[model samples]
Target: MGKSLYSQIGSLQNDLNATVGSTENTQPSSKVNRVTRDAEVTKQQILDAAVIEFAKNGLFGARTDAIAKSAGVAPRMIYYYFQSKEGLYQAVLEQPASEFQQMLEQMNLEELPAIEALQVFLRTVIAYEISHRYQGMLLFQEANQNQGKYFQQTNWSQPLTYVTKILEKGMQEGTFCKQDPYMTTLTIAGICVFYANAYENLKHLTPDVELLSDEMIERYTQAAINLVLNGVLA
Candidate 1:
């Protein structure tokens, strides 16, 4: 028979405790690395659970106890790593922004044609918004209720600047008509967010449709990319 859930959890706890109790000075380097890795894994678990809680309830409404319960960690662990609920919320926002920056760096947009770069950027945003639906909703809530205070606290400028550079490149190449880069970036971002923000309403209006199915996502993504590109293309 498969292990019971409680038994599995108990086994994991035992393993974690053993790793933590291992003496750093006496243990081999491999054991020390295991301890560090285990700690990171535990911290990540708490963050993942906190994301769901914050997305559903917003920062003001979410509770640390609930996050701990959801993460399957002791409540003290949250305080130990994140310091406070607000700290964890900040980390959540920062993590995605950091990932976005890394992705832009890896894309090497300078090598691609202006139009191709724009398409790749749009597709990436749309796919990320679709996969991380709750993140979009949480951002929306933060903007409305918190006056975007948390957003201002993170390093979001790099990604915004990256998009603006793409737009500027297109204009310089004479492939896209001259326009305000900031406004153009906003327009493209809005276009990508539209379907995701309106998903529930769309589902209500068309009760038979699976709006999130792969086919529908592809259709919407392609349509949005084509529309944005056509508007900007000279």
Candidate 2:
């Protein structure tokens, strides 16, 4: 109801639009191109369509036929590629997390001190959430609909544990103040995720302003950084 919240929502809407591929003007590929590459392309198409449908309509309300139609593929292709609608949803969320894991593997965690590590980690988390808006939408939906129980059972659980481990290591090395690692991780996640979901509210709260522009995203990212690092760093 506040302008600040409304501004955040406007930003989120823009991010969501970018994430769902709605902003792209993709033409249908030739049916003659039904090679292995074509199959993978079609599979991505179906998943992209599914993200739009599922984000707007929830799981039970999302129709496979509509997803197939939007994707320019047969309805059966959705099932053939993903096994089920829910399977496709899980894939959408898991794919980005897998990428995050790869990025983490390439990083030298021990080299960065606690404050810098937290800053970099939080930046990555926020950037990923902004870029992969559909994944955030799906994760939010799962959290509300299943109360986070479903996520707890999936590969989604790995990131939280990873963050906790980093926090513990920082504490052991006297780089961060003593505190509950899990709680700190939850706090960081909440600040990024709650703003995303409540973007509509943020938009209303901050009247007469554009919140999704490049400059505004930079501001939001910095504000998030200030909040988390200030309290955790020794």
Candidate 3:
């Protein structure tokens, strides 16, 4: 028989604990060349582990030892490479911004009409969030933690700059209502991130909702597009 969801969560927690404890207790190996190679390996592993760690636990609750274990690295190696867990979280975030930007750049948005552009962008955003759940989870965690200052410093600029241009185009062409482009971007992003970030918590609240299913995803995408296109006015 399959385990209960609660038991599965408990199992995951317990496994993380064992992995963390093992890494924390092991002593670093002594070979210089081996240490260098190991350090590089550890750093990559840490980056991968950190996306899940920071996403699940946020910055304050996530443990360095847990991250190290998840990455299969010595506990201290995270500090040696990243200086702190916060630094590792920042590194994990860097890739998503560039990846999103490259994807956006490749699309010839200028060729599409305004409403078509909006729909296309929504589809792209939803696809990206769905496909890159880990990256989306990290973003969701950061946004949920509401570390406004940190996010403001790190990410607030680039995406806003790009999105603002698109929204401005939409507004000018009368596809969208005249609204603050920046705030609209936040609303659109919030719509995507909230469900993902809160999925674990939400599952408890709505146990019958099979959120990961293809039907639900299509339902969500359609609802999200409608909500954005037509404001909540009965």
Estimate TM-scores for all models.
Answer: 0.85, 0.77, 0.67
Q: Which runs of model 3 end up more than 4 angstroms from their true locations?
A: 1-42, 76-80, 132-146, 232-234
Residue 164: error of model 3 in Å?
Answer: 2.3
- In terms of lDDT, model 1 sits at 0.79
- Scanning candidate 3 in windows of ten residues, the lowest lDDT window is 1-10
| lDDT of model 1, residue 124 | 72
lDDT of each: 0.79, 0.69, 0.66
What is model 1's C-alpha RMSD?
A: 8.7
Clash count of each predicted structure: 0, 20, 0
Angstrom error at residue 144, model 3? 7.3
Q: For residues 129-179, what per-residue lDDT tens digits would candidate 3 score against the true structure?
A: 665577666665778886553465465366556666777887777777788
Top candidate by lDDT: 1
Instruction: Report how far residue 158 has shifted in candidate 1, in Å.
Output: 1.9
